[model samples]
Target: MRIKILSIAFAALIVAAAFTFIRKEVKVDVKSSQIAWVGEKVTGQHNGTVNIKSGALDVENGTIKGGEFTIDMTSIDVLDLEGDSKGKLMGHLKSDDFFSVEKYPTALFKINSVSESKQADATHFISGELTIKGITNKITFPATVTVNGDKVNAKATFALDRTKWNVRYGSGSFFDGLGDKMIYDDFKLSVNLSSL
Candidate 1:
């Protein structure tokens, strides 16, 4: 009876230890910038940083199980605003027309699957549920991961259509009225993440 009890206790300890090793905190960095034409002969680049909260990376056996990620939308800032007036662009972007910062303040990318990419450099492909403006979509992004000790590096580029998440204002046929020829629906995203 004592031996049986000891066996169970030992097994439980092993399981607990394995679980602990599976998940760890992570940090992700975002340096994506964009150039938008404000008017004739005028353009500016929008820049921002993504700060994550309570991020965790998990591994089961030899495969990555999942990771939880969030982006800090409050950090968004546009550079080179035409003249000293920058409030207009910032206010409009944070309004319900674009990201609706008041209602949906942050964007999230919760992991659903991880796979090995067929790229020559042994890249990793991650599929996750991306939530923006209260809409979630399962999207895939190609990440080139490099393991250095306890750290993991992931870099990739992706695009998002604002209209998909109900951000349909200031777009479409009104293109002719707008300063630019036509506001492009496709917005680019670039990520450079280093996690432990």
Candidate 2:
């Protein structure tokens, strides 16, 4: 009877250990995280910052299993201009000619899968569905992710074709006879996130 009781206790300990290694959810520190964007045209380029509304990451044994984030489209700010110039550009970007922030105030990205990266600097390749202006598209990019104690940090930079989400304001692909006014279809986004 003594030996049987000891075996049962050992089994319970093993089960507890297994539970510790299960997936854990970490809430993102939105105030500390940042997302920057850059859009270029034939004449010049404009860069600005956007805010992450909320997010969380799923981690298991130091590996990121999944994650998702929401972007506040109404928080877009232009960094390269000042005063009226900045406000004008920001207003234009949030209008129907661009993101139409009044109708779709937020965007989202949900991770579908993650894999070990072949790049020397990046730690993983993240494949996910990105939704903007109410349209969702699959995008894959390399990211550097670090997990330490109860914290996680991830950084990545990638470019997406704006036309994919139907933001076709001054795009040459849709309009004609505009030489220097054509805005490039692809815009770049740089993301840095920290989880609490």
Candidate 3:
């Protein structure tokens, strides 16, 4: 009878240790990480960078369990243009017709779940809520997650519909006969996140 009680106690200890390993959490390095954005029009495309204000990752035995990050929308920049054109385009992007940065200065992304990916090139399949201009939507994408000692690197490329967040400036769905002036609804974002 005493041996049976000892066996049960040892099994409980093993299970507790396993749970402890799965509860590790890490904070992301906002300065070292970045989110690059691409916006396309019928005539051309523009690319730029946005700053990550803050973020953190919940890691379970070196696998990403969940995470969240905030974007500083007011820090948006235009990399493909220069001089007056750059300033003008930046202004328009922050205006009421676009993000309205003054009114909505930040965007947010929160991970709902993450699963280990079976693909060769990807490490994780992540599903999350992306909020822009106070509108939230679910986005799922595959990312390459690399863990080296204490450092973690995560990268992903995905697209989001600007109209869904109420940024409909030249959306073809809202306007007709725009010809070359119609901007595409989806914009691409390439994210590279580094965290300890």
lDDT measured at residue 58 in model 2 versus the true structure, 0 to 100:
93
Identify the superior model by lDDT, candidate 2 or candidate 3: 2
Candidate 3 C-alpha RMSD relative to the actual structure: 2.3
lDDT of 2: 0.95
- Predicted structure with the largest lDDT when compared to the true one: 2
Q: Please give, for residues 5-88, the per-residue lDDT of candidate 3 as tens digits.
A: 999999999999877865567889988999999999999999999999999888777777788898999999999999999999
lDDT by residue (76-155, candidate 2, tens digit) is 99999999999999999999999999999999999989999989989999999999999999999999999996699999
- Tell me the lDDT of model 3 at 124: 84
Query: Judged by lDDT against the true structure, how good is candidate 3?
Result: 0.90
Q: Candidate 1 — which residues are off by over 4 angstroms?
A: 1-50, 61-63, 120-122, 173-181
TM-score of 3: 0.90
Which 10 successive residues of model 2 have the least lDDT summed? 17-26
For model 1, the run of ten residues with the poorest summed lDDT: 33-42
Question: Positional deviation of 24 in candidate 2, in angstroms?
Answer: 1.4
TM-score of decoy 2: 0.93
Evaluate model 1: give its TM-score. 0.70
Clashes of each: 0, 0, 0
lDDT per residue (tens digit) for residues 1-196 in model 1: 9999999999999999878744444444333312122211114335433445435556555456688777666655665565445678777777887788888878887998889999875488889998988899888878777655556666777676666777666566333465643455656666666654
Question: Which candidate gets the maximum TM-score versus the true structure?
Answer: 2
